[model samples]
Target chain A: MFDINKRPEVIQLSHGGGGKEMNKLIKSLFFSAFNNPILNNDEDAARLHLNGDIAFTTDSFTVSPLFFAGGDIGKLAIAGTVNDLAMMGAKPEYLSCSFIIEEGFEVGKLKKVVDSMVNEMDKSGAKIVCGDTKVVPKGCADGLLINTSGIGRIQFDGVSVTNIKLGDVIIVSRDIGRHGAAILMERESLALETTLTSDCATLWPTVKHLIEAKLEIHAMRDATRGGVSAVLNEWAMGSNVGITVKESAIPVCDEVKGMCELYGFEPFDLANEGTFLIALPEDEAIKALDIMHEFGCEATAAIIGRVSEDRPGKVILKTPWGSRRYLDLPQGELLPRIC
Target chain B: MFDINKRPEVIQLSHGGGGKEMNKLIKSLFFSAFNNPILNNDEDAARLHLNGDIAFTTDSFTVSPLFFAGGDIGKLAIAGTVNDLAMMGAKPEYLSCSFIIEEGFEVGKLKKVVDSMVNEMDKSGAKIVCGDTKVVPKGCADGLLINTSGIGRIQFDGVSVTNIKLGDVIIVSRDIGRHGAAILMERESLALETTLTSDCATLWPTVKHLIEAKLEIHAMRDATRGGVSAVLNEWAMGSNVGITVKESAIPVCDEVKGMCELYGFEPFDLANEGTFLIALPEDEAIKALDIMHEFGCEATAAIIGRVSEDRPGKVILKTPWGSRRYLDLPQGELLPRIC
Candidate 1:
């Protein structure tokens, strides 16, 4: 219930000078949002009690248009790193957040971003245990950039890209390309009459359910920047197996489909934040889909493809026209700062 | 041993697009520089074996000049986070690095920065277990910003800012203000013909020696952005004790002194990267000093101050002219983008 509006209107250089202003900002803003014992210690580092196999990951969110359709950089920062741990079959536990804010940025927007981060952390039960803030002079940086590093305890073993096998089937957690399309619309200032939103959400709930169901998942990856095409290509190469993806089975919402067609882009190449691809045995595909559905995954979760022995180290796309083509790794920059 | 000279000339948007070009840049540049078993897995997150109490910390390096007199941003990124863990009496083990690069940045310069990071990590025996890279459009960001979040096992316990007691003496590891002075000179293009280098180093070796020597250190901290004055003031307020400092006892290099005089700056208010402050029993000061000296700490290490019961929650400076003054936390921005 901290009234962030009452603080300074804009961040000052002194706020990051590591002096009284910096300390005041840290305590009043960051400490208020991420209230916890470990963070409140005010020590140079957070003392954490961690055990067993742990997963560590880091991401820097420079997504432009900080405020997008469904989320902002703060929410993406938390969900992005948490999803990485969740994909590794780890329970998201602790995270370290660092922000590089441009001076003159509004403090209210920062508070909103922090609020969104807090909301997202609630989904995975992750805690922001340690954080650092730096404010650069105006023009030295964009409005804001967030870097989050997470540590999680591995609960399930043997989940990796190299573990994908020929008999495994690929499952899409939800509709694809919403994140990219949404950002595209926001950035382009498209006035299309559509209720399209970015699929920026935490995947830990669905991932947890899959884990709790005892499904033998071989590999899991969120379609972030390069979308499904990049994930499929990496899996095929890493496992030394062929991945036959049914292009028609891939779920792309109507708005995203229209956006891709208009922009001469492929849906498979568009990014997604919440949607993910799961590789598992064919027998577990149905159960995985069921669990995903039970968790309100928007009824878009479906079996999108299957792994095979032929064409090792390649991903083959079976088009709706009954033709096939190589789904190569994305070649050029589809979108800069797309998350 | 990697031939970094063979890489692309400049980083393009495709290098951070999460596609083929991005993959190539990562494999050729990052993978080669930070080769480790855990990082080579190519998983969404790095799998690590961690146990017991661990220290976690994060820092973002936005130093104005990418390269400085004695080090660069990469070195500061590693040493800064590693020093935080070391200050908490932890054995630096794993680190996560994330980079935000501006498009059109020279790849050769990036390679040199990476090399500096590798060299700095060697001092702490820390591995880059996981990392992320993002490229922002030109004009969105400066050349580069590196965020390093570190994890370490707590080797020594009970090192807290609140542990400072009235009977403890304060010791500084080496001469201060060189880092701030070096950056100031670089930014202002000063033509001072002096060998004033930044004290940018990894402090794990010195801290490790102190712990091994069985010194009952109560509190330890690196004088970073806010400098020695900030550390002392924070210590006093955190522990609810008074601190009396002999201003003449502080170690300041002649070059730094000259710069301070010319710039009308206080040496104690300037920053230091490698220098640190330690509080221990007054009787054990000599033993701690001996260990520091034997471990190659420069002869500048000295007892600069002590804790006191009078003037609680304040810092008193004993000037050379038989006068006393209160040294409050630095009020304004001394220097921005200073580590």
Candidate 2:
């Protein structure tokens, strides 16, 4: 077993190259984060059987400088698309990648990023079957931009925003804001960091486990760019229901909490790449938590709040200080390109 | 019916915006370029019932200066992905688009590009069922980058690269290098003018029509980034066969020929965004050309070459001057971001 803790916290262009360091990075981080049967095949493309309706999603990543703290653009590209499909309760099967590379960008660096993407796709149990590569003159583009589009089959029937109820319990998969905090800390070169890792990961297995465990999940969302507060606010507006989240029950990693305290940032507004907010019936909340925990996620699953009928299209947070504070969607990007 | 030639030669961003100009662009350009049942619906997505195996392909476009002289990035994005699926003899059904926009980009421009995509998808009989959007700070990216992924079904049984045979004739869908020449002329601001337009349009409908007409196509390839000469070289190497082509028989628009002469460039080395090369038995060559002609791509269709067993992994061109020359694959990009 490799020691993930001893690995480098910051990603470099070499991580995307198909070299020794690239292989190491994949085995230690991506393979460990998303271990599964189909993922272990390590083929150029994955073949699977679709038992039901199919859902597809695509996303592009153009994070500056290619790499960042906690995760690189490659990891974000995979996680973003996979999370989108997972939000729809789909079992991701195949992925197509296209790269627009700037001329003069280091080839070694590109190889690392591609290798990381391959490993991430493998671990996520998706195949990178078809791809196209185009090179533009230097300065015409950033160092690199990756576009990933994926196809996944719906794992269960009758899962959608329409199924959400007014009184359903809201469960958070794990701690919020770790990814945002880590990226900020790294960007500012702040001291006092104690192993603050980004929560960038593939969430399909956890979602699949929850489905198989027979939990009546009403709706699911990955609290990514907009964080928990923004996601909750959107859910309230979309479902036309009021939500009350207990601030104390929302999980926060110690490193993230310390960073937020030092930076005077609100944990609720911070982004999380891997964490998910699942709304389920009150009776099945506990089972959902157990199922997610068994998948080796951060597993600090908690019933952070519940849906309500009183104030439609509103999100209220029960603060630690016993004050009811309204949570609104972010007006602008707080940590641009953190994912 | 509108007179396509009388319409504007260069597409403005307005044509892609969802207004009158956009409607006119669609009716004149896209509807004229490709006409099919699936495309005629003009819905957000095209639905298909797969009777057999499926093949998927995708590509992204990030050309600088969104609008080009011959074709804009919008049309290129749609045509590129559609042609990829067509090369595999698949009937394209669905597409997912994701756009990354730089802040401060004109809203009118963005809408225009999107409208163009919708129109092109309609023309090609593909549906844009799902998509995503992200906004980045100004200067972080070019004006916009459009990524499109398409899914198509393999309607035929046992058609693949293995089907190629010696003595098969090579059929080009249209004239070569119009897109590459136009991009270069625009980028260099060459004073020379021509009636040549970019051959940037979807090809799946024509491929489908040819297949339905019972033309025995053995292998197909989109002569894109590296042009006809480069792609033919690759096919020769991949199939372990030799190719002999008559340079005089290879079609070239008069304007393109004049521009190449002025610029000291070879038309064979120039790129084409929308043309395809198909290999079939000599007996079926005329039938395939006839089917393509019925679809309005007849002007440039010609029997330029044939697969031969005299030499392996080589392409020989019989020049119009009665001199034999080796048509080597281009070493570098002739026109970057032509698509």
Deviation from native of the Cα of residue A80 in model 2, angstroms: 2.2
Model 2 score (lDDT): 0.71
Model 1 Cα lDDT, one tens digit per residue, B82-122: 99999999999999989999999999999999999999999
Q: Which candidate achieves the best lDDT against the true structure?
A: 1
Candidate 2: lDDT of B324? 87
Which structure among the candidates has the greatest TM-score? 1
Which CAPRI tier for candidate 1?
high
Could you give candidate 2's per-residue lDDT for residues A1-339 as a string of tens digits? 888677434444334322234346445644444455444433212223343467677777766546666677788788778887788777777777777776666655766776677667765677666665565665666678888888877775545544568779998889899878878877777776378878888898888888788777778888876678767876787688999999999999888888888877788878787898888888887778888888957758788999989688889988899999888765433555454
RMSD, each candidate, Å?
A: 3.0, 8.4
Off by over 4 Å in 1: A1-8, B1-8
Ten contiguous residues with the weakest lDDT in model 1 chain B: B1-10
Q: Using DockQ as the measure, which candidate wins?
A: 1
Clashing pairs in 1: none
After best superposition, candidate 1 residue A210: deviation in angstroms? 0.7
Question: Model 2's chain B TM-score?
Answer: 0.83
